[model samples]
Each structure stands twice: as structure tokens, then as C-alpha cells.
Target: MEFMQADREACDRLLPGLRERLLELPLSELESADSPALALFREYGGTQLLIPADRGGLGASALDAVRVVRVLGGLAPSMSVATAMHHFSIGMLYSIADLYGKDTEIEPILERVSGEKLLVASGFAEGRSNQGILSPNTVARPVPGGYVVDGAKKPCSLSRSMGLLTTSVAVPRADGTNEMGLLLLPADTPGISVHPFWSTFPLAGAESNEVRLTDIFVEPTKILRPPPGLTAQLSELEEAGTIWFQMIVTAVYTGMVSRLAALVLERGRGAATDRARLLMAVDSAAMLAEGIARRVMSGDTGNDCAAAALVTRFSVREVLTQALDLAVELLGGMSYIQSTDVAYLTAAVHAIAFHPPSRTSMTDALLDYYAGKPLVMA
Candidate 1:
């Protein structure tokens, strides 16, 4: 099932350094209301992993990206998560340009990323918002030479340190219809401000906060205007974005499961059967993601991509849920209550289920896909 062994090996070379850096950071500090984890991540060149070689970066394949993320997740779930925003955004940007010959406007941003190791924060569709990922929560109105963007992206990840923000904005058209325009802007552009908003400690180190834009002028070249009809344009972006998002996010939590197993191994406690079951679940979920990665790398963007992404998210979410439950049951109450890191990791892993296209929404979409109909999520 693991088709990309060479990519995995290349990413494996990064593990020792990643684990060392993570071990140096205290769990207490990392789980605090304020932490320097993001700084440490940038210092580690975490943003450069997935950049293409021609662009002056690590040039990790899709499989390579997923493997590295899982390792990072095992060590620092928050960092793994926050960095996923950057990795997946870069992946999606490049894929659109290279595969679909669309969104060539993102080339400049990608160049800066490859050359300077710039971090990109994603404002993609998230949980419970009801606003489809393609349907922009932020709206921009056209002006003389540019557009004036007005709206806020709530809980924007990497709020404090991102160099660029890649998001979609709803642009009003003369025909009284809206076109989705992909917007790329420097994080420190005038009128853009980040405010603390996330109160949960699970991924607190990500500093996912509120980003508000008050009539900011977005230059013409920074916007990519897609064709009309949300479903048509969105389906294209969704197929590309969902595969990487599901793979990277799922890998991160799978790393936490790995770390828990490592803890038990080091302590010489727990039955072999218990640990095997947990690891087997983790491997099953990881393989599902890897299969999707292989399909993506091979440029298979048909319904398989959509179907696999939907299935991967659902399978990983269910497996991780069971794995965490088993970990708690086998590790016992005292260890569960006393081991704060384990407790936090378990809580953090659950956040993956809430990523996007809620299970309820995906069930109908998946059925439509197999039934030879367009996949749409409201």
C-alpha cells in the first residue's frame, strides 16, 4: 500500500532533528496560553519542506510531505497543525498552476516562499461555519485599480507569524452574481490586523486568531478570478485542496498516536495486543492517506480524488477516535489524569474530525459522486 518508499525515506532524514527540537520544549510551556513554538518551527525551516526544487526549496513529494507532518505531529501537534496551513496552501497553489494552468498569479507568492522560507496562513473553509470553503466568508468589492476587501477570517491559523495569507474572497459582478477570487496578500499589509481569539489550549500554540481587513486595497495581480457558478469552480479547488488537507491533518494526529505508543513502550507497560491494535489502527489510517497521496502525485484528479479524500477523512477520524479510547482504557485513570501531555494530545487529535465537510454533509456528497453526479456540499 505504501507506494512512495523513497519519499518516505527522504522525509525520515528530518526526524531526529525534529524530535530533538520538540524534546527541548517543555510541555507546560507549549500548552500555555502563550508559547514560542511557532518561532521554533520557523527556526527549524518547517515551511520549506514541500517547496519545489526549482523554486529553491525542499521539493518534497506529496508522500514526503505527509510523512514529515506525521513525525512533527508526534512531537508537536500544534506546530504540525499550524504548519499544515502553510504546506497545504502551497501545495494547492502550485497544483492549480501546474496541473490546471490556472491561478498563475500565485507564482510570485510561491517564489517568495521558496526563496525566503515565507510562511503562508490558510483561510480555508472550516468547521461549523456553514460557509462552504469555496463560498468566501470575506467579501471584496472592485475599485479603480484594485479591490477593497472588508470582512474577517475568524481563527486564522498562524496569525502571528505568517508572511502571507492565501484565502478566497467573494467578488461582486455586474451580472449580480459572485465570483470567487483567490487573494494573496502580505500579512502586514496596511489595514490587516490579528487579534487573539482562540481560547482553547489544545492547539493554542498555533495562535489561530481573528484576522480583520478593513477596506484593504488588494492589488489587481494578487487576485485570481474563477468562472461563475460556485459549484463548478469550487469542485475543482475542493478536489485539489481536500486531498492534501486530509492527508496532512490526518498524519499529524496519527503522529500523536505514535507518541502515545512510544510512551508505553518506554515505560514497559501495557499489553502487546493493546499497543498493536492502536498501531494497526494508526497504520490503516495512514495507508489510506498515502494511497490518496499517490493518486494525487500521479495526477489522477477524477472522482477518485474526491471519493478518496472523503473516505480518508472519515476513516482516519473513526480510527483515531477508537485509538484514543483504547489508549485511555489501557493506560488507566491515574495515568490519564496525571499525564497532561497524553490528555492534551488526545483532545488535540479530536479536532481533525471537525476540519471540513462535516460527516453529515459528506455522506450525501459521496453518494452523489458514486452515482455519477456532481459532488456538492452546502
Candidate 2:
């Protein structure tokens, strides 16, 4: 808890500098599909925000990380979305071992991350089609000395700058079933390549492209496996990573809505009621998500965390959509102008629901939770 507080403070302390940098970038370039906003963000040591203090990282708690991303989302939506991949990956990698009691050799990588300030990108599966981010899309074939992983993660963020990739793959078990295993390796390993895939202008800075791994060899030391009966226990680990991803990604969009609300305050009239309503709604959504994060950090990963995250994400997306509508309606005709930032922001806000654990999946999961059934989404 103390460490979490410290991380929160570190984020707060750096918010001003991040905001300033975003303001300095030109609106046109910032909206380009090939923006340098992320490059500039890294120059400010943003890569270290989620690293643990023991490993020379910021030791940011879930709350601290959320606050940082929320603020950045407003200033630079693409950068925030891009970095959320790294932060959530770090969150799971740093905490999962301790939670599950596996001495996964991750400290060396964490040390390298801290000392070298290397950026880590996520190749975790996301969205409704993926079902769950932990469900490995890649396959790991066992060999004499190690496993050969072959698959690809499309729309992988931080494509150009990441020095390492953190992902999971399915390994066949002797029991005629497949179990999930998390893997980490250097991004520059032979047979690993990044390709251009993202074309969305508002989010171009995220550099979300395709990362292909072709028969990449990984030793046992680089993989973390659950104890016996992984199928029964897989949900615990999956929820841990999912909660972290949903929380931070939701915060990223909240930051955008926040900026839109502030704009209403600056340049609108006769919309005080609407502005107040929007701000209140955004805050409520944020607080609800924060409550869920606190529980997950406090060691609660049962149906409660999974259910809350699904609902919070659903609610946040709805709130943000409404807020964006109010923003345009309040700002009047000027908002439609192509050159204006509001137009770009409005477009970016719609991409929130497109993230992961799609509405269909969450709806099913939420119903199961309410009906007192095992909280699993197929």
C-alpha cells in the first residue's frame, strides 16, 4: 500500500511536465498516423512510470497508473493508449508471480527495464473476438530444450520503440488439454518482425502494428506456468491481467472526456447545466473504476473483480459517448470543423469500446455473475 501511494505521488509530480509536452506538439502532427508524440513522451522517462521501485521503477499502484494515463489521455490520446499496453503488461508481470507463488525469473528483465529504460509492448490477445486477453492466440510447441512459439499479435502497440515483448501462449499438457503460459523475450530476437497495420489517423502515434513471431525459441526460464490443474486456476491469472488492462484503458478514455468537458467550460455559454452533468458523470465513472482497482490491489480477484471490471468498462464507454455528444452539442457548429482538435477527440473517443472484452462477452459474464454461476466467459 505504501509503495502504491508512492507511485501515485510520482505520477502526480510528473503530470505537469507531460501535459506541457503534449501542448507543444502541433495539432496536425499529433493527429497524423505517424506522429512523434510517443517519441517525445519517452524522452520524459514515461517508460519507467509502471516499473517497481525495488527494481528501480516508479512502483506505481493501480490508482497511480490510472491517474497518469487519464491525464495523458486528455493531452495525447494516442500516447496514452500506446503506453497503456506497457503499463498493464508490467502490472501483470510484476504481480502475477507473487500472487501465484511462482519464482518466474522476471526480476532480471525488470532490472534491465529499469536500468536501461526499455519500453515493453504487449502482445496479449484483446477484444470480443479474442474472448479473453489471457487466452493465448499463439501456440508453443515443446522441443528437447525449449518451446517454439509461432503466431502473431495484430495491432500490437509501441511497435517502433519497444525493446521487449510480453505475451502468453498455449502449451499442450499431458492431460489432453492446453494450458496457458506467459512468455517474455527480447523484441529483436531472430524471426520476430513488426509490420505496419494501424491506419487510424487519431491513433497513429500508438504505432499499433502486427508483431509476428515465427518459430522463436524460448527456454523454460522465460515462461511462467500455473500449478497443477491449470484449467481450474487459469481464470485467476486471466482476471488479474484483464482487470489491469480494463482499468487503465478505461482511464485513457476518461482522460479524453475530461478534456472535452474542460473545453466546454472555456468556450461555451448556456450549457452550464450540461457541462456540470458531463463532469459529474465522468467523475462517477472514474470513481467506480478506481474502486475496482483498489479491490484488485487489495488481493480480491474473485467474481467481484471480473464482474466489476466488465461493468465499469461498459459504463465508462457509455458515459464517455454521452459526454462527447454533450461536448459537441455545447460547443455548437465550430466543433465540426475538420481542423479543430475537438473533431479529432470526438473520433478518438469512439474507439474506447473497440478495446477488449467486448460488450457481448461482458454482458454474458455479468449475467453469470448475477445468476451466481461460475464467472467464466466463453
Candidate 3:
């Protein structure tokens, strides 16, 4: 309709006036590491957008969540990307909380997340070439009462501002094998520290750095182990995680490119046909993302849905890549030379391809899924 009009309205309703505040700040400030965007996001209740209303959250549906993320992506790219990780982590926890009763330990964490507006950072294995997102990046040694965790997550978004860190760890089993489990630990836990890692300037405000944990002790109650016999393929929780991650991330990049496309439309940078093609590319990608979110809301977040999410993500990546290149050209060389904003957005939009489960790595898995095989991440 009016270029993310409904999604912008959803943002205003969820976190009133957040867009205005982000707009007031310069793009350079929002893209810098010292940016106040994250703090502003926290103040605006952005952290509680995905939690269920019964648990003190607004309990927005999956469809609306992606819309909100798309709006944020247009205004503040780094904040949107960083918060996507938070939503992914919390989504996993709450999904488990729904499975288990309220008596579980996850209940308190959910309360703090909704009540305290605490941000949770995801520490899944990413940035490693040819590695699956489910692969544990941290090592957990069995100890009395719990386990000793030692490892690190590089390019971990929200590294500095996260109140809690949710990481995937390889838990030692009695038979000398390993099982994938999620570990929840407070950010202030001993041995947990953040180091400068992300050197990229586009999303420096995301606080994507190295989060190191050395000999960190975790209680048994804090670990959520997936059901057994999920070693071959995706677990239910993993599927949900994958679906949410793909949907949210795809929306973020779509918004980034949409911003550029908006500028082209506003300035009437090129011929009518060229402008129509640009809008088509951006709108198609947004619709693809919404499709995944719709599948999630319909209680269809299974292997097929996960495969569809990945397929949509990759498809959107290609569409947006072409759209971005066309937008930059349409905007003309003078616009790119006159301001840093256009260049910055161009650099940031290219990062979609760099996210986990790269196209090359997921090619075989996607082909197999298309051939009636289960979608496996390796």
C-alpha cells in the first residue's frame, strides 16, 4: 500500500514513537558502535514484542512480529538485526515453556524478559564456514551439580547489552557421546565476557562481538535438552528456531532494501518502468517473508516449514540483491557521491548473504528436501 504503512503502524502500536526517535538520529550514529539505538529500543519496550501477553508481553502474532522487524530494519538496520537474535532466542525458550508447565525454570526467565525488558542474545554457532547452526559452539564438561562451559560465539549480536546469553552447547552424555542442549546464563555470570570482534562498520551498533565463556558453571535446571533421537535431522525446537530466524532475518534485509527503494520512489530517480521493477523486487521479497511467518502462525512449523523458510530466505536474498543494485543505479552516481547514507545502506544490505546457512552450504540439503527427504542442516 503506502510502503510499509501497516507494518509501521504495527511498530507504533507495539512501541509507540520508536520510529520517530530513530528517525531523529543520524544514520551514522545508528550504525556506530556507540549508538544509543539499543538503549532507546529497550526504553521503548521493544524487547517484549514477541512474548505472550499471558506472560507480560504484548504477545504479537508471528505475522505482526515480522512486520515490526521490517519497519525497524528500515529505520535502524543494526538495531533490527541485533534484536532479531533476541527474538530468536526468546522464541525458542517460550516455545519450550509452552511445552513444559509453568513450574519449570524457564518461567522465571520469561517473566524477567517481559517484566524487566531484559534482552537475551543468541549464541548459536554462526560465522563458521560449512557448519550447521545447531552445531554447538561451546563445550560443556560434566561437573557435580552442572557443567563447566568453555567456548565463545563470534559476531554474537547484542553482546554488550544482553542481560542473558542463550548458547548451544554439546552436553556430555553417559556413553561418551554428546547431545545438543541450550544453556541459559546471566550475562554477569563469572567467566562470561565480551570482546571486540566485529570490525564491520555497517552494523557495528548491533554490538556483534566475541562473547567468551571460560569455565562458566551452569546448573542442570538451566539447560533445556531436546528430545532424544533428533541427531539425524531437526528437532521440533530447532525447526521453530530455524523458521523464526529465517523469517525475521529475511524481513530485516527486506526492510533495508525497501528503504533504498523508497528513496528512489521519492526522488523519481529513473523511468516509470525501472521504478516499477524496483518496487516489485522489494514487495515480492516482503511477501515471501510474510509467507513463512504465516506458516509459523498456522502451527505448521515442521520440517517442511523449515525447508520453506530456508528456501524463502535464499530466494529473498537473490531478489533483494538485484533490487539493491538496481536501486543504487537508479539513485544515480550523484546521490551516492553526495551522501554517505546511500553507500552505508548498500553495504549493510549485502550482509544478508553472509548470515548463517549460506546458500552453498544449504544447496544439497534443500535439493534433498525437494526430493522427499528430510531437511538436514550440516
Task: For model 3, state the Cα shift of residue 269 in Å.
Answer: 1.9
How does candidate 3 score on lDDT? 0.88
lDDT of each: 0.74, 0.76, 0.88
- Looking at candidate 2, what is the lDDT of residue 305? 84
Q: What is the TM-score of each candidate against the true structure?
A: 0.88, 0.88, 0.94
Q: Which pairs clash in model 3?
A: none
lDDT of 3 by residue, 250-321 (tens): 999999999999999999989999999999999999999999888888899888998999899999989999
| Local error of candidate 3 at residue 372 (angstroms) | 1.7
Give lDDT: candidate 1, residue 3: 28
Clashing pairs in 1: none
Give the lDDT of residue 101 in candidate 3. Answer: 57
Worst 10 residues of 2 by lDDT: 1-10
Q: State the displacement of the C-alpha of residue 13, model 3, in Å, after optimal TM-score superposition.
A: 1.6
Higher-TM-score candidate of 2 and 3: 3
Q: RMSD of each candidate?
A: 3.4, 3.9, 2.1
Cα lDDT of model 2 by residue, 306-345, tens digit: 7778788888899889878887788777566745688888
Number of the top-ranking candidate, with lDDT as the measure: 3
